[model samples]
Target: MIKKSELNRMADVANDRGVTVWVEFEGRRYGVTPPAATPPLDDTEESDLDRELEAFKAKNGYR
Candidate 1:
């Protein structure tokens, strides 16, 4: 069994590596789950063009 300190250390490493982590503990019961990811901002004109360019590439198999 991993100690709580060890689990916290692992979580720290994961966070440093840009990985998400969600930890839960209830005495003898525990759960380890990665949190949901959030995408970057999408409210700019560049993002709109990016979406359109992606669709164009998909349609032309450029990617």
Candidate 2:
């Protein structure tokens, strides 16, 4: 299992490699800048899209 600190570290590494990490908590959204990158989407947007996709898959009976 990955600890939160480890995950955060990985996020940092990813940022160094041109990736960014977005995290969500308590219905609020926040973003962290990597050493040299930006997150693809804000947490709320990502969460919304994820929810929509899951709903679509469920509607289509996609197991």
Candidate 3:
């Protein structure tokens, strides 16, 4: 059993990373998400991600 303090700390960390974290404890489900939704990245950011994905794929021979 996790202490409430510890659980809340974990949720805080997850929320900082723009994620919704979930856990199951004693047959119950727990989840946390940022209070405010994160905005979508602009075109430049999307293009940067696309380039990174392409590089990763090439490096891993996925292409």
Q: Which stretches of candidate 1 lie above 4 Å from their native place?
A: 19-36, 44-63
Residue-wise lDDT of candidate 1 within 1-63, one digit each (tens)?
668897787677666766645455565644444455797766787889999999999999997
**Ordered list by TM-score, greatest first:** 3, 1, 2
Look at candidate 3 and tell me the lDDT of residue 35. Answer: 79
State which candidate, 1 or 3, has the greater TM-score.
Answer: 3
| TM, every model | 0.37, 0.37, 0.45
lDDT of 3: 0.85
Compare the candidates by lDDT and give the number of the best one. Answer: 3
Residue pair clashes in candidate 2: none
Instruction: Give the TM-score (vs. native) of candidate 2.
Output: 0.37
lDDT of 3 by residue, 13-52 (tens): 8878978788888999888777787698899999999999
Question: What is the per-residue lDDT of model 2 for residues 10-48, given as tens digits with 9 covering 90 to 100?
Answer: 677666776656556677655555663455878999899
Which candidate wins on TM-score? 3
lDDT score, candidate 2, position 4: 82
